[model samples]
Target: WQLFTKPLPQPQSKSQNRQGGEQIVLLGLAAMAGALILAIYASGATALYNYSYKAGLMLLSLITLALLYWSLERLVRSPWGRILKAIREDEQVAKALGKNVFWYKLQALMLGGAIAGIAGAFYAWNLTTVYPSNFEPIITFNSWTIVVLGGAGNNAGTILGAIIFWAYNSITRFVLPTEIIKDASLGAFRIMSIGLILMVLMIWRPQGILGKKEELTLGQ
Candidate 1:
């Protein structure tokens, strides 16, 4: 008789993921730089630089959003997506069914990192600069808040939530009473309001406005 030992799988460390994310951001920045250089060579440097300012990145942003929304919709409806959902609901059950949960998780993390890289490129374009401070913990917290507000399982809800979040930011800047809430405290007040709203919603509608209760991972 022969005895065989199967090695236990090692879980991915957060530091590894953070390093991977940094690499993806660097790649995205490189690609954007390359495109800019090409554009400057083809068109005059002055012309290309002016175009970036006058052409308005809004059109590109909208087109990107549309394509992303369509792609995500298709992805969530696919078999692979179904497997991901299964894993999310219960990883042990997915593993029991012979599904490679680790592979699925790695794929998901890579895909998410790619998306973040693209977004980071857009952020640089919008601001015309990038710095270490730009990628802060607050950004991650805001992303989570958007996901919770929109409903985690539904992509459309996520988009809608982002729109609402930005709209609130735009409105409150002008509408908020500066007499009571000073300019310095206005931002904090808005965030607090959002938190209060989320608390109320969580107590009454934990699945979110658009998320199906059956698909809510909170129940799991």
Candidate 2:
């Protein structure tokens, strides 16, 4: 969703071509870090299902998401925010104006990750069990669908997108054919429909219903 399509650091960045070697290195490091972290936590697996498990996990996720977004908002001190906006408009010009472009991008990445983390936590909560297959790329793809349907760069639009998408999702649960199709099959098709809706909107009304075109454009 917001993490995938909206751009790397917003999907429309100029130097986005990460070479093969670079990708491999990045992924390798990520895998190694993941393994190390898992090893460190291997001894604490039993507590994952204790009485306080749900509460603790939920609270941790909530706090993490809140703090992450809060830090980003703080960075948006009117002047700095404007600078970031201008950078979003044209990075070269922002740098010419003496703004720290790299730092701003880094901050944006952190903020974006925090935002995605919030979405992920909500997703995790809604699921009764955790498994590898559940977190397929499609989940993110569906989120992008929601984001695009509501409008890019518009948090309100993202919320609306979530609402509409979920509505469609729930409706299909009881409305789609049952004799010829199971609930899981309907849900899959519904997600695909959401993706299709996103593509259609991008072609017909990219700005979304309540969003400004310029503000909701690919970059800005």
Candidate 3:
């Protein structure tokens, strides 16, 4: 597998190359899922088994957030991280130079999935249950809004985006007159406000408040 990532002494057939790539992707996904499950179970057991559910979840969220931030920061600064950025910019060029483009992409997918899985677990824990409605398409759009508002490539920006998004909702819910706007109308107003904010951001600062102009891949 390691040898496949380096320049091959001789070119392999297309079938063989395809098979290898598929195997790598499958293996990477399995490993990522397994690790995520194991970590969640271990943390849940350690926290929930010994303490109240709310307390356990709180502890777990703090620990998870810290570790996630630290790990991602380190990973993004590593040599392999540079390769990831290069691949993102031009996968064909990376592949042409004997870099395992499939492997890199698979790694990125697995990493992203694992992080999202952890977040989902925490959210479910908070809600005390998971429902089909929780996985709605609008959730994906909201995530995109957070990412775009914070900054696409900046981790700190992402965190800031989430904070700002939620803070706005929290403030509005507290300040808005429930007598004038019923629950449904209040929800609709929040969504409308978010849409308006996003539109203004897109027009005035498409790169995001914290995102650098160079980090943007939109016009490029």
Candidate 4:
């Protein structure tokens, strides 16, 4: 992990996750579902919006996408973000400083839920019509790798990480397992290969390609 300068999962805070309760998860799932529904609905609405007002549906889609970005910004920059940061540093100190820690945590979670919902809306509109089948577990894990490649705490790093991750994935998928090596379902092999890469990255260089050692600390 030190070799890469990325932050591996450390014994962070139980409250970090405790703050995100079942409600948030349920709402998030529901939002994804709703996005699927809306996408199907858009199959009809698209023509209507275009016929009735020309580009109206597409415009709405653009607005929805804008809202998604806005929501992410809000989640990252709002008061809740501060609270989460505070809690991350020292919950006891934050409470001693007279912060309504629980409320801030709750708001952080609900904001996450809403942001996911907005993302679903965009996915439904822009991507292949949203469906549960479309959301695979690999999507989540892939995101993790991207986060590592970029810089754990840096948005710019995350973007770069995404690019690097996809490129690496494509290259490995093509290069590994030549005709002689034989194919045994990329599903399992790729999983192991990626996991190995992550494990090696974690052990050797956890700070990420561009992140600083100070920025990648597990805790005090």
92 Cα displacement, candidate 3 (Å): 2.4
Q: Please, what are the lDDT tens digits per residue for candidate 1 over residues 62-111?
A: 56666766776687789877777776665555678887766666566676
The lDDT values for all models are 0.59, 0.51, 0.62, 0.54
Choose 1 or 4, whichever is better by lDDT: 1
TM-score order, best first, reads 1, 3, 2, 4
What digit string (tens of lDDT, one per residue) describes model 2 on residues 13-107?
54442111112222222222222222223324435675344445445544653454355445545576666666666666666787666666555
- Over 4 Å off, model 4: 1-80, 173-184, 216-220
Q: Give the TM-scores of the predictions, in the order they appear.
A: 0.74, 0.60, 0.73, 0.58
* Tens digit per residue, CA lDDT, model 4, 1-220: 3433332233366445323322243234334333433443445556755544333445565465445445544655766555566665566666678775566656657765775666565565455456788878876666566666555444445546655555565555677657634566665777787788888877777867765566444243
User: Per-candidate RMSD vs. true structure?
Assistant: 8.9, 10.5, 8.9, 10.4
Total clashes in model 3, counting residue pairs 3 or more apart in sequence or in different chains: 0
Output the better candidate (1/3) by lDDT: 3
Better of 2 and 4 by TM-score: 2
